[model samples]
Target chain A: MSKTPIRLTVNGLPHEVAVEPRRTLADALRDDCGLTGTHLGCEHGVCGACTVLLDGEAVRACLHFAIQADGHAIRTVEGLAAPDGSLNPLQRAFWENHGLQCGFCTPGFLMLATWMLEQPGPVDEARLRHVLSSNLCRCTGYQNILTAVRTAAQELGKWREGATPA
Target chain B: MKCPPFDYHAPRSQAEALALLARHGEEGKILAGGQSLVPTMAFRLARPASLIDINRIAELDTCRAEANRLRIGALARHARFERPVVPGPTGALLARAAEHIAHAPIRTRGTFCGSLAHADPASEWCCIALALGAEMRVLREGGERLVPAADWFQAVFTTALGPDELLAEASLPILGPDWRCGFAEFNRRAGDFALAMAVTALRLDVAGHVAEARIALGGVAGTPVLAREAAASLLGAPPTPDRLRAAAALAAEGFEPTEDAQVPADYRRDLVRAMTRRALEGSLAA
Candidate 1:
């Protein structure tokens, strides 16, 4: 089987790689692109471990082919930090709240939370809990993760308000 | 569990996709959203020699409201219907059902037509499509045909779609002003495959009598089961609690549910009855 040449922009970086047509986006990100922040728990779509943002919407990286993401912008956990290497609000909140126990599922949670926080208005706790339920974290039992996301949303909200010109 | 090696063709047009499907015939599989196909491939359950990626086909990514129906292109993601993309009762029903699908991320990439094509018995789209009498527009090499939802799904993971035919779009019948719809399902987790599900659409006449009713059940049969007898029982009668319960009980009649490791057949039948009652009551309340 011949490999297909495809180009994708990941974490604001563009790269062209030759991969088999069957190669999943998760494997391509970890192996070809060398961004292993996107973990793969249940290679199937059930586990949300490989969640990433494709064109700003969260999707399971393991469920998509690399070639299918040729012209799309993908954001992984590695991209969550600012260019100055400072932790983003969500990451900082997670750290302060002790959101992770083993840290294996943190990347997926971060990406998912990034997408949720990017939404229009302030997300209520109930809605946030519902959205956060999509991704699983076996160790944390999710209480602190929920608190972290809530705190991050408030922090982001304040930051956005401050950045706005009065 | 990596997918087996295969040739990938990303066609820019539906015509090109159809040509690729025709050329490869049974060896080709249309890749749209890839929610189900990719997972199955990763598990080595399905190995097509060629994957015709239809994501690039611009014409197949649309959701338009026709005068009498909502035309959803094959590549229209499930998330598009999570809200009232199309106004009115049909759109409301679609939004209700779409939110019940796996999750936000899965809904982002999973196509509504892809679910209908995959024909999963536990699929929310399958049950809603059957209840709404949606028509699948299939395109082949030389011609096209419309398969009504009633005749579309054949069995588990099977459809009336021929090997060379590509489902281009689905036209779901719009609900009239008098129509009210509701969808309910029981799953262990929020996004798990439904153990038993019910979708209902009801229209009451000016006299408060049942004018028309469409009830469909999932996870109780090989395909989404349209409760024809149960719906018939509701016709011309007042949608009272008694009538709804009797009709809900009748919905489980003549259906043989297979017992799985987690749930027994009897329990599933009871769920069908209970869900049917809830769906009917909710639809009326809506």
Candidate 2:
């Protein structure tokens, strides 16, 4: 198949690229755009390894096409931390609370955690658990992960010293 | 490593999209968020000659509140409902159901139309839509048609949708003030399909009496199945624990769940009882 023209703003940077119809967004991001922070595990969307934010929401990049994104804004784990390689508060909270175990599913978990924290109004623990249950983490069993989310909620709206490059 | 060779088309408007579908017929597939379609393509499960990306069509991405119902376009993603128009128990039950679908990322991109159109018996949206008595609007090249929840879903991964038809929109009647709603489902893992699921909507007057009740079950049947006889058990009765228990038992008695990783058919029937009872209690509390 011939390559299709795709123009998308990925990780805060706009890129105009050519992709075949067969390629998925995960392959496009890592191969065409050189952003490898997003890992591909379980090419099927069962695992959270390939999660990324498309237009400010988390979606399985492996299950989407590059050309399909077209004019949408896409964000990856690489876009979450500060531009200076500094850790965002959610990252620090994860580190402090030992949220990760093997770390393969860490990026997806972090992206989901960050998004959930941004949601407005009543954040009950049970409700929060139900919300986060969609993204799977095989290694850590989610106990520590839940702890990190709880700890982060306790320190809500307390940003670190300088803002990260959004 | 990737999906098979196929043509990609993005129509600017709904008319253009319908034209594309009308032309391609069975060889074309409507892409709604691609949550289900892309995977179906990657695995070669559904090999359409052309994958028409309908997400770009402006008219398909809307959540409009009609005079007496909520009209959701086919491309409206699941995550859009987290912050709903109306809030409270019984009010905006669909929004609450949308939240529990997949993960935040899937919910963010997975359209409820896609979820329901995908026709997964394990999905919460299908069961919830049926329990709420929603109407699915399907548009064809010649004309349009409306399929109620009962008629829309047929069997596993099957619906009444035809080859050249596109699911245009789904309209659900907004819950009244006297209604109480509850949703309960059990899944082994967070994002995986449910082993057994149940949803209930009840309307009670100021005297706290049961005026109407609707109960539906997913994951335990050929399609999103409704337990109407069980619901009838609650009709014309007060909202008491004994009455609720009897109704829940009737609901459970009717379900014939299949054996799978989650549980045996017998256990799922028992689970139906527990889930239905708990759902009733929760709805009453709301």
Candidate 3:
């Protein structure tokens, strides 16, 4: 297979790489861009471990080709932190609320939450649970993950008022 | 898993895409959202020699209500319908059904026309398309034609689409204010493929009786099947609880469900009955 040179803007930085047409965006981000924070649990779309924001929308990185993401703004877990490497609100909530046991699925969860919170309006508890259910978390049984997201949502003023917390 | 080696072509215009599809013929596959196609490719279930990516074609990314129908272009993503995109009962029905599709990430990139083109038996959009009598616009290299929903779906993972054709747009009838729609599906978990599902659309007469009813079932057959007998049973009558149950029973008894290791034939029949009743009841509540 011949390599197709494509430009990917990751975390507001432009990086040009030549990848084969068969290469997925997940692989290109991890191998070529050397950003391995975005994990790949299942190459299939069932697992949300490879979730990323493509042009400000959440999509499974494994399900999209590297060439398909060409010229699009790609955001990964590595882009969630400040320049001084301080934990963002969502990441801090995970830490304070014990969101992860093994931490393998944390990055995907963080990226997914980032996209949800960026949307307009407050997040209702039911709707938040529904959206967060898109990704699977095996270690913590998902209770703590839900708490972490709610905690972060409250801090960011994105949580709906009067919505009872679980 | 990695996709099988294939040449990629991103056509900037619909005409260019049609030309590429014509040239590659059977060896070419259209890539819209790639949510389903890319996964199957990664698993090596489908190894097309060429990929005709239509995402770059700006003309195809449209979803608009024109007069009596909602014109959904091939590039209309599923997430676009999370909220009612149009006014009336049709938009509400679409919003309700779209919420059941996969999840947020999958919906963000998956295209509605692509879902119809995939023709999965359990797809929510397929059931809605069949129930709403959608018209699919197919474009070949130099010609085009409209295919009604009845003639569109042939079998599971198959459709009326030809190897050299592209499903350019789908037009769903914009139901009137008098119409009410209900959608119900059974899945073990959120975002899982539905085991069985039903879509119902009813237009009430002045006396609040059933003037017209349209019902479609999914996941019980190779394609979404219209419940003609069940729908006919509800004509000229008010949908009481007992009446709904009888109609649901009629629907369940009419279908010869395909069995699987996980879902038995009788179990699917039960699901059909339950989903049909629930869908009908939901419409009445609206």
Candidate 4:
């Protein structure tokens, strides 16, 4: 089959690339565009290592075809921080709470947690745990990860309120 | 991993999509949300010679209610279920089901049609559709038809859809007033496919008599199944714990589930009961 040419938006920049009919978005991002922060774990959809935001929602990059993403915007782990390269609030909280160990699964967790915080209401622990269950961590530091989300949610709420002013 | 090579066709309209499918026949696969189909492609399980991506067809995503039925265009995003095309009891319950599906992201990209058409027995949509007695509208080269959830789902990983036919839309009967619904199941992890799942809908008459009761269980059977005998056992009675237990016991009467690592059949059998009991209690709790 002939290679299919497609354009992908990554980290706020558009890049053109020609891919085989079925190269997964994960492989194209890591190997073709050279965005290495996105890890590959199960190579199946089960592991969240290849997690990325496809149009602001978390999805398994490994399970998606690169050509299928034409005209879509994607955000990976590398985009989490400030444009000036300062640590994002979530990254700072994760560090403060020791939310990650071994760090293999941190990117996926970061993406998942970031997306979850943007959701409209108070995210209780049970709800947060249920959302995080899809992402597996070999480090087994779930308690810390849970702590980080709580901290981030509180911090985020305060930050938003402060920005709005009385 | 790379998926097997295949020519891609992006159909801009429903007519074009129908034409493409009819011409390609069984060799073409319709791409809706790609939440499940893409993964299967990576695994080399389903390699269609041609892929017709229907994302550009704006009409298929439209949702509106006509008369007593809600017409959800097949390509409607899963997130659309969170709101009402028509304000009613059934729409409210469907919103709840949409929230529990996979996760925030999956729901955003996954379409209502793709989820049902993918027909994973463990899917919440399948169970909800069955429990609510929803109907599907499908289109072929020269014809269209309606298939109820009961008739639509035939077996594990299979639907009654013809290869050249496209699911145009789904029609759901708006649940009437006095209806109560409770959905419950446990997956090994959140957003994972359910090890076993159940959705219960109950309606009580003016005198507190159970007027209508519908129960569906998934992941424990080949399809999202309506517990017929179980429903028969509770018809016209007060939906009490004892009646719920009797209905729950009938879950194992018709089918046997296969053993997988996350959950064995014996465990699923127990979960089916627990979920049924809790679902009934929770529905009544409302």
Clashes of each: 0, 2, 0, 0
Q: What residue runs in model 3 are displaced by over 4 Å at the alpha carbon?
A: A161-166
- Whole-structure CA lDDT of model 1: 0.89
* lDDT of prediction 2: 0.81
Q: Is the docking of candidate 3 incorrect, acceptable, medium or high quality?
A: high
Candidate achieving the largest lDDT? 3
- Per-residue lDDT tens digits for candidate 2, residues B175-229, read 8778888888887766667777889988887667788989998888878888888
Candidate that would win on TM-score: 3
Q: What clash pairs does model 2 have?
A: A58-B105, B79-B107
Ranking by lDDT: 3, 1, 4, 2
Question: How closely does chain A match the true chain A in each prediction, as TM-score?
Answer: 0.92, 0.87, 0.96, 0.91
TM-score against truth, every candidate = 0.96, 0.90, 0.98, 0.91
Angstrom error at residue B7, model 1: 0.4
Tens-digit lDDT string for candidate 3 (B163-238): 9999999999999988989899999999998999999998898898999999999988999999999999999988
- Candidate 1 lDDT, B1-286, residue by residue in tens: 9999898999899889999999999999999999999999999999999999998888899999878889999989999998887778888888888878998899999999999999999999999999989999999988999899989998899999999999999999877778879788999888889999999988889998888889999988899988999999999978999999999999877488968888988899999999999988888785
Task: Evaluate model 4 with DockQ and give the value.
Answer: 0.50
Q: Which wins on DockQ, candidate 2 or candidate 4?
A: 2
Least accurate stretch of 10 residues (summed lDDT) in model 3 chain B?
B235-244
Q: lDDT tens string, model 4, A108-137?
A: 899888888877776766667667876888
Computed on alpha carbons, the lDDT of every model, listed in order, comes to 0.89, 0.81, 0.93, 0.82
Give the winner by DockQ: 3
Q: Model 4 segments beyond 4 Å from truth?
A: A158-166, B82-86, B254-267
DockQ of 2: 0.59
lDDT of 4 by residue, B6-123 (tens): 8888888899999999999999999888878877887889888988888889989888888888888878888778765567677876786776677666676788888889999888
